[model samples]
Target: MIAIIDYDAGNLTSVERAVRFLGEDCAVTRDLDLISKAERVIFPGVGAAGSAMESLKKYGLDKALHEAMKAGKPILGICLGTQIITSFSEENQGTPCLGLVKGEVLCFPDDMKSPEGEKLKVPHMGWNNVTVLKDHPVLADLRPEHQFYFVHSYYPMAKEAGNVLAETAYGLTFSSVMGRDNLIATQFHPEKSGKPGLALLKNFIAWKP
Candidate 1:
C-alpha cells in the first residue's frame, strides 16, 4: 500500500483521489508502522511550517520519516510538504525542518520584481511551467514546460544543485522539483494541476527509484 502521511496539516483528499484514479491503493495515516511498511509514502503538508512540524513531532511522524529515508523507500512531498523536507524555512519565523534534503525554504523577496520592472506577486498562485533541469524518473516522459498548479509564498533553494530536477520562473528562477535517491518532492500541487499533473502522479506511482 502507498501511505500518505497524515500529520493533520495537509489537504490530502485530492492526492488520495488522484492515486485511486490511477487504479492504485493508498492510505492516509499517522501510524508509524503503516508509513514504514508501505511500498511508498507521500508526506504532504499545507499551512504554516511551525504548526505542521508540531503535529509531525506530536505523532512521531518526524522520526518515522527519517526511518523511511534510511530504508530507502520512495517518498514524495507536495508544496509545503516539500518545504518541511528541507533543513529550515523562513516561514513561521525561522522553523527548523526535516533536513531530508540539503536546502532551506525561503519566502519570495518582498522587493522582488519582474525584469520588466513590475512587482511580482507573493504566493505565486495559478499555473506555471516547470522547466525540467535534469531527467528524473517522475518526469521521464513529460513534455517540456508542462504547466503545474502552484500555491505558495515559499520555495526551496537546494544546496546540492544536482538534486534540482526542475525549475520555474516567477520574478526569477526557483527549484520546482527536487529528487535524490528514493526521495522526491514538488513545489507544485499535482492533484490540482490537471493533465500534466495527473501524468506526474501516474509517473510517481510507477517510479521505483
Candidate 2:
C-alpha cells in the first residue's frame, strides 16, 4: 500500500485521485505508523512551506517520513512537497525544511528577465518542456520533449549536481525533476499533467529505487 501524507496541504485530493485512477492501493492519512509501514509514500503538497513544515511536525509525520527514507523505501514528492524535502526554502519567511536532500529552495525574482529582455513571470505557471539529464526508473517512457503542468514561485537548487534528473527552461533553466537512491520528486504536478504525467506516475509506482 502507498501512503499519501496529508497535512492539510493543498492538492491532496488530486494526487489521490491520480493514484486511484492508476488502480493502485493508496491511503491518505496523517497516521505515523501506517505511513512508516507503507510500501511507498507519496508526499504531495501545494501550499506555504512554513505552515506545511509546522503541520508535519505537529503530527510527527516528518520523523515518520525520515524513518521511511532511512529504510530505503521509495518516496515521491511534488511541488511544495519537493521543496520541503530540501534543507531550507525562502518561502513563507525562510522556512527550514526536512533536509532529506542536500539543497535549498530559492524564490524566483520578480525582475527575472528573459534572453530577449522580456520580464518573465515569477510563479512560472502553465506547461513547460523538461530536458532529461540522466536515467532513472521514475523517468521510464518519459521524453525530454514532453511538457508538464507547473505552478510555483520557487525552484530547487540541488547542491548535488548528480541529484538533478531533469530540467526545464523558463526565464532560465531550472531543475524540474530530481532523484537520489529511493527518493524521487518533481517540481511540476504530475497529477495534473495528463497522459505523460500519468505514465510517469505509473513508472514511479513500479520503480524499486
- Measured with C-alpha atoms, the lDDT of residue 86 in candidate 2 is 93
Which 10 consecutive positions of candidate 1 have the poorest summed lDDT?
140-149
For residues 42-83, what per-residue lDDT tens digits would candidate 1 score against the true structure? 888778999999999999999999999889899999998899
Which portions of model 1 show Cα errors greater than 4 Å? Answer: none
CA-lDDT, candidates in order = 0.89, 0.91
Please report the TM-score between candidate 1 and the true structure: 0.96
lDDT of 2 by residue, 1-209 (tens): 99999998999999999999999999999998899889999999898899999999999999998999999999999998998999999988899999988898988888888789999987899998888889887897788678899999999888898999998888777788877889999999999999999999999999987
Please give each candidate's TM-score: 0.96, 0.97
lDDT of 2: 0.91
User: Model 2, poorest ten-residue lDDT window?
Assistant: 137-146
**Model 1 residue 9 CA deviation in Å:** 1.3
Cα lDDT of candidate 1 equals 0.89
